[model samples]
Structures are given as structure tokens and as C-alpha cells.
Target: MGEEQFKGVFVEEALEHLTLLENALMELEETPDNMELVDSAFRSMHTLKGSGAMFGFDVLSHFTHDIETVYDLVRSGSMKITQELIDLTFCAKDEILCMLRNDYDTIPEVQKKKDELTKEFKDLIERYRDGGNGATAKGTLKKPDGKSIPDEIIVKDIEAPRYTYRIRYRPCTSCFLRGTNPLLNIEELAGFGRASIVAHMDDIKFLDEYDPDACYAYWDIIVTTEKEIDAIKDVFAFEDESSEVKIEVIDVSGELDGGDQYKKLGEILLEKGDLTQDDLDSVLGLHKKLGELLVEKGVVNADIIEAALAEQVHIREEKKSQQTSVEETATIRVPADRLDTLVNLVGELVTVQAHLTQMAVKRIDYELLNVAEEVERLTCELRDNTMNIRMLPIGTTFDKFKRLVRDLSKELKKEIILATEGAQTELDKTVIEKLNDPLVHIIRNSIDHGVETPEQRKKVGKPPKGTITLSAIHSGSHVLIRVKDDGKGLDVEAIKNKAIERGLISANAELSDSEIFSFIFAPGFSTAKEVTSVSGRGVGMDVVKRGIESLRGSIGIESARGVGTTITVKLPLTLAIIDGLLVRAGAGSYVLPLTSVLECIAISKDEIDQNHGRELTMVRGQIIPYISLREHFFINSTEPVNQQIIICEVNARRVGVLVDQVIGEHQTVIKNLGGIYKNVETLSGATILGDGSVALILDVNRLVNLVEGVERDAVKRLGMASEMSVCE
Candidate 1:
């Protein structure tokens, strides 16, 4: 309805188009011959160019046009999509983002960069066109079977009788410098067909202080022309370069006189009682401007005044609608903050509904209980809907690894093949956002450190190109993502010696193969002889560990020398809520993730045995290492004659935790500890129970590591113990 509102819509549509461009570029990297990806890329660029002009982004529109031309060739099958083309498109997409933000002056080098990229794109297309490729031989680009690809493919065909053209004319701010009357150009165009000039007053300054010579108004014209589209373009041929003009042809065949435009105008006139029904019918038949005809026939009051005012709003909205259609196809762009706010509101509704259900059950009121049950059902549905809104396919993140592998393999002079599977696995938007960097780090490590050189692979009787596989799948309530490289794996003995040499562990440290392999995740632990840019300063793996931990996730590694290494990360489906097993220790509540809990047991004082100051519990003939939560957190309480032990597993290692009481399962809403407690270990995060008490979530992996480390230290002291004694 207004220029400001129209501009807002345009901005949103531009963002949507940009996202499509990014996704298509990534897809094109894998399916270089996919005509659909090519066509979609071209369409996104074309729509951006059209919408940019409508919203007064002249430089952006002009710059995007060049890249669109290159894509147009690919879309028509005149040129093939290659890595070079996709890379150049990525550069162009970055430039478009700069233009959208009006950061042109700050990025003076942008034009040069764009020119260079476009030249590269043109050269690649030309190479394919002149290389005697099938595309070049046919004169016209042809499909694989030799059918000539058409210039434009209409996916949907519909019939329309009349076409409506929307014309937007925005003059340059410096138009007065050339002594040009923008209105004269508008008038010249109106002469070709029946046209209405709606002058946009949104940009008009106060009349008393306005510069009469300075053009402040833009015109939106709806011109019905039987002539071809070229005729409309020719009207402003002289001023086209200096002014912004957009023309959209809307086919309105099956309707009675076009749609909303006619209906709105009729309703406005009827409400004002400008003309009787008979008068309106005659004016409509005469094909004259309705407002002018009404005044001329003495049907009502002021004719020129109201018509111009009403026409301006109608024309602006029409232009906006046309631009919107060009930019956005099937999806709408929404701000991240808005989505976050919606999520928070949904969470609050769930919390409140839970409380209501609790109260309903306690009161034993049948009517209230029914209402509470319905509320619970609706709240669950609403929560799911919100979560779905934040779920994005993992394919997008996985696609980036292709480029990484290509570049790193070339630099290292090694042949590497990256294979991806189960890329359609979905994750929370926040998780995906944070996952990108960690995934890149892991893949880079695989290419630079894990994968062997071609010579070594050949010597090992393996293929020259080492294979690295990235896969993701839903495992229970968590997602399991694996990055496996088929090359020389970690040497456990070597890692143990390296750790001992670095003073990270004692020389006498006796550890299992898995424990030794995990030492790589320790800070400042690196076995590399020299540090390089790729990885192996021992920096990124630790960061990856911290990041996974921050998400309440776990990371583990499994490897065999001369075979391969598989690094697996387990993450929850949603971070907003979790099913937790609540327990009490030291007058406070703590939660252990239900997913990791194995089983709980109540052991009498006789059941617990102490050996060398370490506690152990015999559970079904298995000696499970046990830790007392009261002692760990410094709770000064006498050990109960009968204490409960909660056995949990982390990375397939079991440990028993002694607690005062088992609080059963809880629906946990995770709440972060304050800045002061951030460095505290053995706790991943804190959650609020239904009773408003906070329960700290146990970091099971860290607990297992600590307990296992103690066991290793104890074993080291009994170096000369017999085999049977070591096993005991």
C-alpha cells in the first residue's frame, strides 16, 4: 500500500532468492550435468536482477545482470557447469550480498573482483563451447540425445486473454543536472496505450521547502497495450541508462476485467458515491480512466483530485506484487530473531501447560482434567511444529566438504575421494550453524593428516585415491555423524609414548587401546613432527571436543593401524528439552541423560568393597568401577547403610554413580549456568524441574574419563603383578 512497505517486501524477497542461489551453486558442484540445478541458478539470478531494479538498487541490478548472462548459457545447455563456474558464482553471490547492504563504497575492490570472476566464468564457458563438445557441434545447444534445448521452458502453461503491464519509472536524483523532465518520458509512454500516472508522494518533501527542480516523485503506470513488449521498452530508450524502469506483463485472461485492481477501484468509487451504477457501467464500457469519466459526467464532486490520489496507491501495490512474484517462488524469508521468539513462546506454553496438568491431576476434577489433556495434546503438536520450522537438512553443510576436499587434495598432491551418505538427516538450525566449523576442521584433518599419499597407498596395495566417507543417521534420540578416512589409522602405542613424552601422562601409565587413542583429544597433544596450516598443531581436535560437549553431545574415535580412523559424534535431536533421570546428592538435584542410563541398583554396605582406596561394585559377576557423588562434590554425610548406584555408559564404558536418592524421570528444560560456573567440569548444563528446582546435568563422558584415568594410574603401580592379578 505504501512505498516503505513495498521496499520491505522487496528486501525479504531478495534474501530468499540469494539463499536459492547458494543452495543451487552447491548442488551444481556435485551434479555438474544436472539441467534442473542449472536452470534454477539462472532463474534466481534473473529474478534478483528484476527485483533489485524495482527497489532502487540500480548498481546491484546492473552487476547481477552480467552473472545472469553466464548462467543463462549454462541453463540453455550452451555451456557445461564446472567447478570453475560454481566457484565464480559463489564469488558473484558474495558480491550481490555486498550490493544488497549498500556497502559499495566501502568495497571499492568489489568491482575489480567481480570483473575478474566474470572473465573466468566467460573463459570456462567459451572453452566448453569451442572445445568441440557436443554443445558446440549442434550450433544450438542440445541435450544428450541431440534434442535442441529451448531458450525458455514453461513448466506450467495457462491461458489468459488480456495481459497487464506494470511500468515503474524512477528518475535519478541528478536528473535536473541534465535538464531532463522525467514526467515528459512518462507522458510519452502513456501515449502508446491507455495509461494512468500514480505519482508516489512517499519521497516527496514538504511543499514549501521542496526543490521544484529536484525530482521527488516516481510514477507507476498500468498500460494496456496490444503492441509487443519491445514497443514499451523503446518509449524510454533515451533515458533507460540514467533512470530505473521495470515492466512486468501479467496475463489476465480467465478473469472478468483483470483481478484486484479493477475490483478495488470499483469499491473505492462506489463507497465515495462518485457515480451511479448506470454511470459506472457506461464509463467502464467507454474504456476511459474511471475517475476522469466520473467527474466529466458530473456524477459526483472533485474528479482530478481523488483519482490521482487513489491511483498512486493502487499502482505502487501493483508494482510491488509483480516484483514479489519475480523474486520468491515457493518459500518466504523470515528473520531469525522472529523465529527464535516464536520458539521461546512455544517453550513457555509447554511449561505452563505442564503445571496445569499437574494441578488438574491433583484436584481430581474430571472437567478440568479433560481440558488439561487437550491442552497437553495441542502443546505437544505446537512444540513439534516449532521444532520442524527450525529443522534443516544436513545436506547443505555436507556439500561444503566437496570443495574442501578438492582444494586440500590438490595442495597436498594426494588423490582423495570424498563420499557422502545419509546427507538428508535433519538437525536443529542452531546445531547446523555451529556444526559447520567443526565439520570443516574434521574433514581437513582427514585430508591432511589421516589420508596417506598416493605413493604410500600404492605401496599398501590400495587404490591410489584414498577414500574418506562422511555419513549421518538418526540413532535413537540422537544423531550419529561419522567421518571415516581409509588410510593409516592411529598407532595406540605411539600415542601412549607421545603422551608420556609430553608429560601429559606418566611413563608408567598403563591404558587400554581406546583410552590411549582418546588422548589425542587432550589439549596440546600432538604427535606430528612439524606443524602445518592444514591441522596437526593439536589445536582443532580439542576445540571440536569442547564444541561437542557444549551441545551436550559426545565425541569418540575408533582406529586400527594401516586401516582407517572413524570419528563419531553423537548429538541430541533438539536442545530445547530432554528426558533426564534425576537424582539427589549433597542436598541438590542432578540429572543424567536418560539416553545414556543403563540401569540402577541398590547395594548394601556389604555389597560395596574397597580395594586400594577405590570402590567397586559386583553386579552380576561384573566388577563396575564406582564413584561416590557425595565425596566427589564434598558433601559431608555419613555413607548410608544402603546406598543407590546409578550405572551409566559413555562410549560403551560403564561406571557406577552413588547417589542419595533416585528422583525418577523428568522433562528437563536446559538452563545455562552463569559465567562464573562455565569452567566447572563434570557437568554439561543445568535444567529446571517441574518443582522449580535446578538439576545439574552430568557430563557422562568426562566422568568416565576421570574414572578410567584413575584405574590406569592404579594399574601402573602394580607393574610386576601376575596376569591373573592384573585382570582382578
Candidate 2:
């Protein structure tokens, strides 16, 4: 692979390892005795370190090695996990993220922190690996049977660690000035196991042509190391600044100890990269030890032949391991922009199909109308299929919050458990991405403010270990996501007092429990007396509400003094298109989301006029507030004698929306109004109608808010008039 392509793959693979490593660590903290988690963590660290080294990220590799060493002890039952160790691991995880992002400015600070934490790991390894002096720690690193651990164990569970590499190192003419010693690197590689070298004198110039300062010497070094190719390459980290170093793994587990080997001469020659495959294939017909024959013909030097034979055995061993690895499931990673484009194209197709249907209906041709209906059917099917492709299970997004809960519980010194249900609930990928932050904020609030401390819970006769449940499930065409907490619920009177004190509501304001609970979403409204890093600063719920609402969703809260609090967010299945009820206020048609609509109630203009002050009327003995679309949009035309009120629920309260006429259901292809209608909160967006007219899509949540705003004003006016009458 090309360098850039390989780097992309490395980053993708490295991030996966990091995620698995973090999760395993979290699980390990809960069950420190679980060997499976220990092994998982060990494997992740091993892979990460090797990959980092392979990509020339020596800093990453070296730091991870210390962590790997500690986990090795943990896996072997030499070291027991402690709270101190888990804290250090969390710090290490953060440092690894900073390193992966390559934030140079932050890396220096993280590096210093890494050094401090890694030393603790090193000390633990030293104290447990032997029974000698400085044994202040309680854990033993030594094997219980008094058996010495092999050097191979320091790496991983491998049968053999003998990999031969033929190195060609030629330094820059002025490399000596860089203070990089090539011989030192060579010595380090030899320290692992075995080594041999043959200096290439062919490149050396004649004495008259050579310069004293510029070195002309280079070498072909043969070495076998008890490490991976990446580990050996790491030795040359500094050497690459001014040298050309080519190190290829010629063999992985060759039995080079025997003077007489079983490897054929042609195979060895081909592996050494000196001879091509065609040359070996030609000689394979002569099924004899070809090396002796080659020696007899004086084709290659004795030393060169010796190195190839040593490499030949290890190559075959490498092949055996390759054949044993299970095939990995392949996946393709596509850019998000491409998916967005596809969704947009499908949206256009929906619009065009609507236009075609309108054209066929206007023409009154049976065949054209039939074809149009068929086209519409196919279009709807296409839209559904395309949307399904974009739908992803919310479990992945939910899984991410485990770490958040873990670290926060630790920092706050509170015992908490996060349980999730309906994690497999699917939603549009776009909606899922937008939902993450809101979920995070809500979870943080649940952890910080909603959930009580262990001692506090016990005093209230509740379980000391608080529980926060995150759940998602489909409700018809929408999804209901609930973040429920088991702790001291919202103190209603306290919230009421806070709302009154904040001037959000009057003392005489009579509201339902849900309405009173929704006061928590007011901007900068919080009952929190103290501010911490978590959600107590009063800046969270408002943002969460706004985020969910921006996606055509609504959030509601239910709380009891001692029971608990559950914040439920209702969201559309997809943001692309929806089924809506089309209606007209004056000349303009508006579309109301079909999912929210209950039943329409027709009322005459006379009834609407008589009930002017309250903007409400009796619907089956229920006084439901209604929004007059004519007045809402400032329609200049007079209202028709017969009008309809669309009954819909928003924020847990059912309300009526007045319209001039009800024009049945519409298959809406929503389009952005962009800058033109961006400021109009009452109208969410515009959609193209069948007749090529633009229909404004009403924001039911905002429409309910408008009716509430009118009521607040009426109450203010009434209070003022009453005071004036008392003065009179």
C-alpha cells in the first residue's frame, strides 16, 4: 500500500484498538479478577504498540510498552488491580487520545503526565517480577512456582521470536554531524538474540577520490531478533533523519541453529530478494539441495548463501501462522458527505414524483394517472429503502456513555450504575449523530444533579448504588428515548420557588406538573446552589431542549419528590421527509406533522369570535387552547365562516390549531427555506406541494409556545387592570 493509504488504515485500526482497550479497562475495574478482560486489554495494548512503532510513532509505542508490561503481570496473576492503578489507566487513556490526534502543543503536557504515571507501572512491575529488595508493594510479579519467565513472555504468547532481517544502511554524507551513531542501533538489534554483518566495500571510493569528512562506508547486516519487524525498525527512529535504511523480514521462525538445514537453495535465494520467482520456478524442477549445486558452480559468495539459508526457515514458519489466522470480515468506510449527497438526491426524486402526480391528476387521463400512481408507489418504496440504509442502531452511540458515567462516578466519589434498554433501536444516522451531545448533557445532569450520593440515598431508604437508565424504543413513526434516573427526584416546590424567583412564572400561575417540570429547560434556570465541572451551572437543559427541537423533536420531564426523574425525548424517525396534514390559513397552505395530529374539530367563525379572549373552546368537554393561523401568520384575508381546529399534543398538553380549510394528507418533501425563513420559529421549514406551490411546515412545538405566550400576556393585562380597578 501507498504511504498515505497505509497511514489511513493504521489510524482506523489504532482507534478501534483504543476503544476496545478503554472498554476492557472499564470492565476490568468492575471485575478485576476476570482474566478475559485482562487478556483483551493486553492484546489491545500489544497491537497498538506494534502498530505505532510500525508507523514511526516511537513516542506512542514506548509509552504503551509500559502499560503492556503491567497488563502482562495482571494477566499472569502476578499483580492485582487497585484503585490507584485504574486511575492511572484512565489518565493513560486520555494521553493516548491526545497523542493519536497529534496535538503537538498538548502532547508535551501529556507526555510529562505520562512519564509520571508510567513510572508507577514500572515500579509495580519491578516489585512483583522478583522477590528481591525494595519490596514495599504487596503484589508479586514472580511466578508462584519459582519458575523464571521467558524473555518471549515479556513480548506475548508466541512459540518462537526469531525473525531474520537483511539490513542495508547507507548514511548521508554528513550524518556524523547529526550525532546519530549507526553502530549503536546495530548493537541494540543484536542484543535481542543473534547477529552477523558484512560491510559493503564496493561503494567505497578510491583513496584519491574519497573525502575525510564524508563517510563512504555502508554495510549489509544480518540479524535475528526476538521481536516484531516494527520493534526492530524502532531502533532506527533517529537513524532515518540522515540515512537510507532498508530492513526486510526475510524469515520469521527459521531454524538457523542446525548447520545442515532442510530448506531448498532456490527458496532461500528467492526469499533474500536477490533472485526473482521465475528463477526459483525454473530450478524447482531439479528437486535437490540446490545450494550445494550453486556453491559448486560458484554463483554466490559463501557468506551470502549462509544468510539466505538462515532466513529460509523462518519464512516457512511465517507462512504457517498466516495460514492459521481466521479470515477477517471486511467493511468499507465511506465519507459522510457522500451519504448526505445520496439522501439529497432521493429527496429531489420525491419532489419530482409529487410534481408528476399533480400533472397526471390535472390532465384527467386514465393511463397517465395510473402510471403516475405506479411511479409514486415506486418512489415511496425507494425513499423507504434509502432511509433504511441510513438508519443505524443507537447502541453504538449509547455504548460511548459508559466511560462518561464511569469517570464521573469516580471523580464525584458517588456509586452509580448505567443500565440501557432497547439499545438496538434504529434511527436515521443523521439524527443519531445530532442526538449524541444532548444525550451526553442529559446523562451528565442525571449523574451530577439527579442521582443522589450513596449516603444520601441510604438516608432516604433508597439503594446506595444509584441507577441511571438510558433507553430507546420506536413509537409509531417516532422514537421515544428516555433518560431515567433512580435518585431523589426533582423537588417540585423547590422548582416552583426557583421559577417564581427567576420571574419565569407568576405566583398565581396555575400549571400542570409537566408544565412546572418544563421550567427546568428555561435558559440559565437552575436550582443548583453550587457550580461544578458537571451540569450544575444551569447551562445544560436549555441547550439540550434546543438541540432536540432543532431536529423536530420534543423533550419532557417527569419527577416526584422521592421516586426519581425521567426525561423523555420524542424524535422523528427521519429528518429528510415526513407525512403531514396539509391545510390553508388564507392563500398559504401549511403542513402539520401527521404523527402529532390526533383529530380535527370543525368550528364556525361565530364560535371562534365569541371565544376571542381565551383563544380556546370546549372540545368534548375539554377546554383546549388553539392557535389561529390567520392571526399567527398575520394573514390579511378574512377567516372563512367554517374553519377547522387541528388537535395536536406538544409538551404533553393537547392544543388546537385553527385553519381555514383541511386539505387532506400530503407526502411532504421538506426543503430548507434557508436565510429567508431562518428567523421564523413558527414555521420550521418549507415543502414543495403537488401543484408546485410552497407550503410552510408548522412547528407544532413552537405553535404551542405561541399560544402560551398569548396566555401569559393576557394574564399580565388582567393583573394590571385589576390593580387599576383597586386604585380607582
Candidate 3:
């Protein structure tokens, strides 16, 4: 294989191992005494090192060796896990990531970081080993069970009893071409204990028939080890179908005469598949040792019989580990664009079927109508199935925040705990991808601006560690995500003052609590007294709001002066399709995201005139503001005498939108608007109706804000009009 092909595969596997290492380190922090965690961490580093070396990342291999040694010490209980050690591990993890990203141009910087980390690790180990003693001493370290580790060596083969095993290893002629190095496997097996190798050359062809690239040699071996049978198999983890390895327990549990107990020459040859059982029996009868007779008969070579005191297929049938044995559901990785094309085709199918069903409804032929109805049902199911394939669990995104929270908390010298719930909630993969950045900003804002210092928290009788919770739940057709922080919350008066000072709000203007909090999202607006690296420069929350809205979602903020704050974001389950609340206003039919529409009510002409053109109306004793779509869109068509009120949640408030008629719910496939209509407000996108008409999707959030701006303008005009009347 080409270097590039193996490079990508090696990188992918290395990343997977690194993730495992990080997870193990995190768990070790919580349970410092868990030896399994230490072993897991060590194994991850070991695999990464081996794979890195095989893939020609020698720098990576060498650098990781030092880090791996630290974990080896940890696994042997010669070192301990401290905050400093875990911190260094995380730094090392980041460095390994950099290496994988091939920051080779910065090799000096990378080497410098590697040296610094290794020194820190050795220093930390020395600190624990010396126990602050001024004088150095060398002695065996005893375990908690009072067993002393031999002073002559470190951990390997320490406690477990050694058992000698005879082995045979044979490899495919083309194994090296596929990147399999049997020597590497043999070298690793040697790490277990003392190993003796005998090269068997019977498989070698004559000079004229020989191929340089073809492997013609096999091996018979003997090894004494304390490791498990599985550990021996692990040495050949990269073995493929063409390779053959057989291991037998000739001497286990202290069988002293292990050499004499090994399989005889004919039996060894039979075991390697070089001879049949009947051939072995016949050969055994001919000579005491088969070597001379086999060579005379030209049946085999001297080397083949010389290594008779072999050894994997015996252990091949050994039950695999639970982790490996479980049946793996087969899957194939296809390009994402192919799945998207499949969805698009399914979407077109739905559109066509909708047209067919509509035509069938108007026909009197029952048979044709039934077929159309069935086709519509199948199309809907297909659309749902196709869309479901794009859904992914949000937990993968949530898991990434642990590192973020850890790093930020350490950098700021604050103790913060990230609490997450409902991470199993799934959303369209595209929506989840876009949600990541906005969520990061929100969490950063929570940490930088919202959460109080540990000292501050304790003074207020709260826990020393502040907590930021991220939660998601399926609510109807939307996912309700909340980022809540238990910290000293927003000061309304301070926000109002800052808003007025920045010209975001007028002095002496009366505003609700929600309105005061909304000022934080105004561009270039901040209540922060000074800028910090994290978030104080006013570049965060406003962009967060805009990003959420871009996904056809909405953000709402709730805060208490001294208690805490919660920012709730409502996102559509999918961006590709929506259950739309279709409505008609003037000449155009519009699609409102069903998740945004709460209810539809009637408005009477008498009530409209009673209000005398005021845009506020009473609904069940509550005075809610309303917006007129005809005026907003600048439609020349006359308004309907009796209009319907679509009550929608805007900025977490009940706002009514007036439309000519309610066309009911629809399964609308969203299509983006062209560049020409990009700047238009109160219109998000468009969708195709059953009759092939284009219905614009309303931007409910923006529509409500527009009406509020108009209301403020009208109030100012009326006041000036009243003053002029009095002056006259």
C-alpha cells in the first residue's frame, strides 16, 4: 500500500485511541485508585506509540514514549495522579493532537513543548518518589499487599507466574506489502518474556523460483511469560487471514522438563499443516528424528526439522473478549452528499405524490383515488425515513464541552462544574453542527460574565463551585435547549444604565425586565466594566442570537437579580423539512414554522374598529400586541374585513399576527430564497405548495420586532401631534 493510504487509516485509529486516553484520564481523576483506569490509559498510549512508529511518525512515537512511561509508572503504582499530573496529561493530549495535525513547520516549538512536558512528568514522579527527602535512596518499592518489587528491575513479569509456551508463526508471502510486520509482532511477544527463535527455511524456493518480496521463512519459537494467553494473542492483533499462528501449552504451571514435553518432530510438522496425520504417523515409524529421513526423501529441509521443538490457531478458537466478540451490526460509510441527494430525491417524491393525491381527491374513480392515497402514504413514510437518517444524537456535541469547561475553569482559576441533561436528545445533524458554536458562546458568556468567583459564591452562601447546566428536551416539533448558570445573575438596574449610557435605551424610559435583559444582545453593547479575553468585549451574545435565528430557532433569557440566569433556545427538529402552519395574507400564501405558532383565533371588524387602529388587543384578560401582515409586506391588496389572529411566541412573549386566512398545517419541504430576496425582513425561506405555488416562510421573530419598532415610532408621532394641537 502507498504511504498515504496507511497514513489516513493510522491517523484515524490514533485519534480513536487518544479519545480513549483522555476519557480514561478524566475518570482516573475522579477515582484515583482505579487500577483499571490506569491500565486503560497505559494501553491507549502503548497502542498509539506502536501505531505511530509503524506509520513513520517517529517523532510522535518517540515523544509519546516518554508520556507512556509516566503512565506505566502510574499503572505500577510507583506514581500517583495529581492535579498537576492530570493537567500535564491534558497538555500532552493536545500536543499529540497537534502532531496528528502535522504541525511539522513548527517542529522546534513542538519539540520544545515535548521536552517541557517530559521534564514536568519526571519532576512530578521524582517529587512523589523522593517524598521530600533531602537524601536519595534506592530500594524495592513494596505494594500495599506487602509484596516487594524486585530492586533489579521495574514492573514487567513481576507477580504473575511464568509459563513457557512453544509456538509456530507463519506469514503470508505478501504480508509486508499490506503493512504487516511479523518482526514487530515477534518483538512485542519477546517483551512478555525470554523467547528463542528458530528459522524454518523449508518453505524457501530455489534461487531461480525465489521472489525477493515474497516471504519464504516461517518460525518455531519458545517463550516463557507471566502474561495471559490473550496478551500473547494481542501481539498478533494485526494478523490477517493468510497468517497462521499456533500456540500450545507444553509447559504451564511450572512444568520443569518443558523442553522434553514439547511436541515431537513429526507431530510439530503435522500441527503446522505441512504434513497430514497419516503422513506424520508413517514418518514417525521410519526414523527416531524425522529430519534426516525427510531431507533424504526431499520432503522437507534441514531447517524445517531443526526447529521441531516449536508453536496460534489453538488460541484462535479461544473465546474472544467481550468487547470483541459481540456481534457487530454491519455498516458502510458513504459520502454525506450521497445521503443528502437521497433526501432530495425523497423530497421530490413527496412533492409529486402530494400533487397526485390532490388530483385524486377531485376525481370520482375510487380505484385511482385509492392508489394515489397509498402513494401519498408511502411517500410520507419514505420522507420520514430519509430524514431520520440525518438525525444524530446531540450527546456527541455535549461530550466535547467537558474539555472546554475544564480548560476555561483552570485558566480563570475558578471552580466550575458543567452539568448536562437530555444529551441523548437527537436533532438533524446539520442543526447540531451549527448549534455547536452558539452553544460555546453561550457557555463562555456564562463562565466569564455570569458565574461568580468561588469566593463570591461562598460569601453568598452558595456552593464554592459554580455550575452551568446544559439541557435539551424534545418539546413538540422542537428541541428546547437551556443553558442555565447558578451564579450572581443579571442586575436589571445596571443593565438599564449601561443600555442608556450606550444609547441602546433612552434615560427615563420604562421597560420590562425582559426588555432590560434584551439590551445585552444589542450589537456593541456590554454591561461589563472592563474587557476580558473570554467575552467582555460585546462580540458574543448578539451573534449567538443571530446564529440561533438563522436555524429557524429562537432564544429567550430569564434572570433573577442575585439568583441565576437561564437562556432557553428553541430549535427546529430539522432544517430540511418542517410541519408548517400555512396562512394567507393578501396575494401571497406564507408558511409559518408550526413550532412557532401557538394558536389561531378570530378577530371581529367591530373589535378592530373599537380599538381604533391601535395594534394592541385583549385576549382572555391579557393585552397582547399584534402585527398587520398586509402593512408589513406593503401589499396593495385590500385587507380582509374579518381577519384571523395567529398567536406566536416571539422573544418568549405572546404576540398576535393578523392574516387574511388560516390554511392549516402542512408537511412543507423548505427551499432557500435566492440572493435577490436575501435582505428582505420577516421572510425566512420558501416552500412548494401542493399546487406548485411558492409559499414564503415567515420569520416570526423578526416580524414581532418590526411591529414593536413601529409601535415606538407611532407613540412618538402621537405625542408630537398632541403637543401641536395644544399649541394651536
* C-alpha lDDT values of all predictions: 0.75, 0.80, 0.79
Question: TM-scores for all candidates?
Answer: 0.65, 0.71, 0.68
| Candidate 2 Cα RMSD (Å) | 19.9
lDDT by residue for model 2 (209-242), tens: 9876666667667776668888877888776556
Better of 2 and 3 by TM-score: 2
lDDT winner between candidates 2 and 3 = 2
Question: At residue 87, what lDDT does model 3 achieve?
Answer: 84
lDDT of 3 by residue, 123-205 (tens): 76565554421212222345567665552343332445556677788988998788777888878877877676788776789
Model 1 agreement with the true structure over 101-171: per-residue lDDT tens digits: 64676776887876776677566656555544444432335568867665344222233233446676788
- Candidate 2 achieves a global lDDT of 0.80
Model 2, residue pairs in steric clash: 128-141, 129-141, 252-314, 253-314, 254-313, 254-314
Error of 1 at 162 (Å): 24
Clash list (residue pairs), candidate 3: 167-311, 168-311, 245-312, 246-312, 247-312
Model 3 has an lDDT value of 0.79
Q: Rank by lDDT, highest first.
A: 2, 3, 1
